[model samples]
Target chain A: MEVRDLNFTYPDGTLALEDVSMDVHAGEIVAIIGPNGAGKTTLLLHLNGTLRGNGVVKICGRRVEEYDVKELVKKVGLVFQDPDDQLFMPTLYDDIAFGPINLGLDEQEVRRRVEEVLSEFRLFEYRDKCPHHLSYGERKKAALAAVLAMKPEILALDEPTANLDPKSVRELITAIKKINEEGVTVIISTHNLEILPQIADRIYLMNKTVLAEGESDKILADVSLLERAGLL
Target chain B: MHQEIDKYAHNSPLCNLDPRMKVISLMTLIFSVVLLPRLELVSFALLFSIALLFVSRLPLRFALHFLKWPFMFITFFLLIMPFSIEGTPVFSVGNVIATYEGLKYGVLIALRASSAVILALIMIATTKFGTLLKALEKLKVPNALIQILMFSYRYSFTFAQEFDRMRLAARARGFNPKTSMRTLRVLGSMAGMLFVKSYERAERVFWAMRARGYDGSVRMLSELKAGRRDWAFACFIIAFAALLHLVGG
Candidate 1:
């Protein structure tokens, strides 16, 4: 995945992104770390054509706008921070099957995918329950499972660790690593620095633009850079 | 929190019955009750509704609690009927005549309304809301209407929780509500904030849906299959409704 000279301004005249450029190779876990209002969410929204900015976003060597919207979502699955927003279907089972059903898959295929994700996430017991009934940690996993059921090549998550307990955070990191091992490129934007070194293969520290990009160890060692980005 | 009726519905022995059959049978029963010409026949319908409540295994106390609102609403109209209608006077209070014909008319309306409401409640109390909506969808209800009902039912709980949180926040800040201009102002502001928050949430939800390949329409796995028992139960209920109509006629 590649983004070049991306610039985005909200309708209220706030510049959310400024000439941002980045790249992510296949089978790598990339993390975008920054302070609040750093346009981390806006950038992730552009990955799946949810928002059209002023620059090019390429997935698998094709321009974002070049592929149809339906086809684009299958290639890059974007999970919102709030599971409530993403899991709007009446039940968790329906929510997980939503994307595949929209992809025009047959009923049997959709059911298979939903069952696969439910067992993988250990959410089979709550399949018929409403999303609101699940705990925060379960909701988070269910949201990710909902997106993963589509089998996207690139999974983009916004604030995956926000509002989670320590155990849930660790479990989410492990899940991300497991997904990466299975060959799904993962990109997450978060301000949580504790899990950065553990899950991130590379880190991009940014506040509206690419401040710095390097291996996780190099970025973690740069105190002055972290201070300037407000991580301190 | 789950609604009281929803709890019973999920646990009801009748829950496993196909929702389409349940809806069709109960709806037919409601129509028969409403169409009954004699107040005595309406009594039979009311008895039948009580029988349904028993079969649903819903406790009498819960049913009475659920009936309170509709009964209160219907009472307002029933009170005015005896005073407004022209008939033979049965009694008088402060020159206001209460007539036997008006009393009979009021009783008929009350019985009919109660019977219909009870039957409808039985239908709702035996099926999950989502399954009920799906049954409606399969019964030729428009997809757009079904979608609207589905989302409204699903998000009502979310919004209710949001409102509860705001209320708690107000209480934590030492805010006390009473009937006054100040209280009204605070309430108005809270309502305005809720509207703004809901608007923002709606936009985010739309984006989320689009991200998951949502086109204009929604599709779900239809796991409803009517078996022989469902058909038999539906036939029995419909036949019973016809018998009531015939006996009344």
Candidate 2:
């Protein structure tokens, strides 16, 4: 995944992101870290073409704008920060199967994929429950499973551990590692700095733009850089 | 309110039955009750609906609670019918009169309404809301209308939570709604805020859907199929309703 000179301004004249760019290679886990309102999510949105910005974002050598939105979604799964927003389907199973069905997959294939992802997330028990019925941590897992069911080449998650407990956070980190092991590129935007060292190979510190990008340890150890980025 | 209904739906005996079959059974019961010439058949239809509710394992108290809202409207119809329908006068009071035919017509109307409500309760009590939406899709409902219904059902719970939070915030500030201009103004502003928030949420939800590869069509992962028991149950209901039609006529 490649983003170059990305710039975005809301219709109300607020510059959300400016000249932000980053590169995520295959099988890599990249974390975008910064304080709130620092364009982390804005940058993630551009990864899957959910928002069109004045920049170049290419996936597998093709521009995101050139690919059909539906096709782009299959290649790059984008999971929102709020599970309520992401899990809009009436039931967990439907939300998980939504992407595969939209891709015109057959019934058996969609069912298989939905079941596989649900079990992988340890959410198979809540497969028939509504999003509102599940606890916050389960809902988050279900949301992630909904995207993972699409089997995207690149997974983009926004704040995957926002409301999770410590145990849930640990479980999610392990799940992410397992997913990355399966050769799918993972890009997450989050404010949880402590867990970054364990999951992210490379980190991009952004405050309205890409302020710094380097290996996780190199960036995590830069106290002055983090302080300047408002993360400290 | 929705969560309460969903609780019963999940545990309903007919939860595993095809939603299409359940809907069709309901419509048949309703139409048969309406078309039955004799009030006896209407009563039979009501009894049949109640029986099905029992078979579905919905508690009797729950069924009565679900029917309460419609029962109130039916009660109004019953009260006004005695004054409207022209017939032989049975009793007279100051500027008020009751007639025999009017009383009979009122009872008939009450029975029909009751049967319809009972069947509706039974259907809703048995089928999951999500499954019903899928069944509506199969029944040829317009996709846009179906989507509107789906989204409203999905997000109304969230909006309720938002409203509850706002209410608590108002209360926390020592604001109590009463018959006063200040309270009215505050409530109006609350409504406006909720509308703006809901509108923004709709936009975010659309983006979420787009991110999930939704391209105008709401497809289902599981297809509905009528098995032997589903078919048998549907046929039995239809045949019984038809039998009542012929016998009652």
- Highest-DockQ candidate: 1
Q: Chain B TM-score for each model?
A: 0.92, 0.89
Deviation (Å) of B32 in candidate 2: 2.6
Q: List ranges where model 2 is wrong by over 4 Å.
A: B1-3, B10-13, B36-40, B82-106, B172-181, B223-228
Model 2, B155-224: lDDT tens per residue? 8898998898999999999998899999999999999999999998888778888888888978774479
How would you class the docking of model 1? medium
Candidate 2: lDDT of A68? 84
Clashes of each: 0, 0
Report per-candidate DockQ: 0.78, 0.66
Instruction: Please give the lDDT score at residue A119 for candidate 1.
Output: 97
Best by TM-score: 1
The alpha-carbon deviation from the true structure for residue A35 of candidate 1, after best TM-score superposition, in angstroms, is 1.1
lDDT of 1 by residue, A73-173 (tens): 99999988999888887789988998999999999999999999999989999998878789988999999999999999999999999999999898898
